[model samples]
Target: MCRLALKTANEPFSPYEVLQAMEAMKEGYDGSGLGLLLRGMEFEDFKYNPRFPILSGIAHSRKAEQRMDEYMDDRGYELKYDHRFAMNPEKMSGKMRYRYFLRAYRMPPAFKDRPQEEREEEMLRTRLDLRRIGEENNGDLTVFSFYPDVAMIKEVGWPMEIGEALCLWDGQIKSRVCMAQGRQNTNYGINLYACHPFFIQGIATMTNGENTAFVPIRDWLLGKNIPGYIGYQSDSEVFAHILHYTLRQLKLPLQAYKHIITPLSSRELETHPQGDFLRGLREVCRRLIIDGPNAVIGTLPDETCMLVMDQKKMRPATVGGRDGAWAIASELCGVDAMVPDRDPAFDFQPMREHTVIIPPDRKELQIWSQHDQLPLPQAA
Candidate 1:
């Protein structure tokens, strides 16, 4: 599958740009489906109610919609604003057989003043509950994300076809950061949940390769007993959960994620300053280690965008952009299409042992290597 991630320092941008880039790089992939994950929302309701969770999903019928409304009311979630897509009727059948809705809901009275962790946990539980209800009723409802300032859209169709059907180019749905994936349709068959750009809480990621170690990782995460980690519809979904577990649950540093998923060799670790600590992690997180050819591009709760590749470096990824905007993709041509006019010399592929990070500041981009003492920061 092809993936494109874009982040801008100033102004909200359209998801169309994301699909455009993916379309430009559509060669090997069949584009069986498209998934769009957006953050840093530019909608008016989001601007006014930034703290309220925005539920983005689909409902198969009016009965399902009524069930959702009643459930939310009983759970004490106050609806603040609602935005439903005017779906093109022709595309609303078969795999795309549902109505998409983006509703912003205020936290329940009990959670309004609760700790951030508690509030977030409740939100996740609510989403899971809704998902369970949907499954019990023959997939009547499918909630992708229930977090503030984040929205996701997944439909089985060509990038532009789905875009036009959803009326994404209308410009009402815009964000400062967007990660879009054009599915290549592999072993898993074509399912919406199996699409890339999977999200949980505030962590969203889209990968370009298969996870050979998916079962082990999924088992380990399920062992954690976190409801948000329940969905394994896509092997790559584990990547986002692993990130959330490491950063939010374990309270580990951002760089720790790179070491956990793609641990360095013993000899290489020995020369690193955090070698001792990393060695300990290698054993503890052994089950979490990925054994596949994958390139991951993700965004953190803090809007920090990052790209890292598997040890095998089988999947290609490139990062390039100018002062106020940046883009990462599976191909250089996609990057060129997203952020053109920048000096090509500055656009370099991240090495197998490296991680490219761009914090929300957007002032500079940092390149951190497993063997290096510090990340080399370059002017944005």
Candidate 2:
């Protein structure tokens, strides 16, 4: 199992803070890599830019940078501003470490006034094509995320060291919501691409346990016409894919995702008041059911964030914080690292077969069990 921690708030918070939280649970992971996805950014130049795709990625060599520019222009993307990472790490030596590059682009003017859905599809498709191009060419590049306000940084190193080297406390970078992971090499060899906190479009996810159900899930996603579902370096990446397929492709709600991956038996489903309604959902998405010891936390496209565990509850997770900010972690100490003085009296563990949902704007955390997840009908 790896260490997973996600911190989200109404105001911008540093990813390094979450990295420190992952460090607090260092006993669980060896720290082969660190991955961070930040949303609702406050970067000085990027924060004020008009609506456009802001791409953040890793370029292994000089050739990779040139390759990216050519590919983007060839694909009808106009380069707006290419802002290089500004970091001068004193503790580390040798060629500025890994450069986290950000480039803002204007969609071809022709795409203007198109249905919102078409624009989203094209953005995701082009990003996927770029990743494939980068990987096949002599240059090795992985564009972590390509949404308007989201920025991601991933690398091969200790989480705390990477965080400190990047200077997360610095004012230049920050986000209102961040999904972060510290990789502990277990089932596969270490590769920066295999790191956690996988992102697709606006959806991002990190898991603390293995996904035994990954193969079937992968196969199902591949069946779709989707192009971005190419890499599966880490089995947990499928969890992020599952979220994308359910919401983006199938057009379901976030709670429906928890139902897809962690469904209850028919008899158990009947216990909920909306068993009849849930039955329809179960029948349609049964193939998406997961079989494993896993706990997942993620942000949906709508900004509604969630934390859930498999029916077995083999994984450990704790949720704690006050209104306006919340932290989810594989262990209690991880949460403590983010919100130091959070009311201990207010903290609680999400039981097996349940999910904790924090609405897009509200600070309160709500629960939806495997039984009856839908809101109750209003009084007549």
Best by TM-score: 1
Error of 2 at 142 (Å): 1.8
Tell me the tens digit of each residue's lDDT in model 2 across 141-183.
7777787777788877777777766766576777788888888
Would you estimate the TM-scores of all the predictions? 0.94, 0.92
lDDT, candidate 2, equals 0.78
User: What clash pairs does model 1 have?
Assistant: none
**lDDT (tens digit, per residue) of candidate 1 on 69-181:** 99999999999888866567565344555578889999999887899888888988999999999999998898898998888888887787788778788788888888988
In the order shown, what is each candidate's alpha-carbon RMSD?
Answer: 3.5, 2.7
Question: Which regions of candidate 2 fall more than 4 Å away from where they truly are?
Answer: 88-98, 373-380
lDDT scores in order: 0.82, 0.78
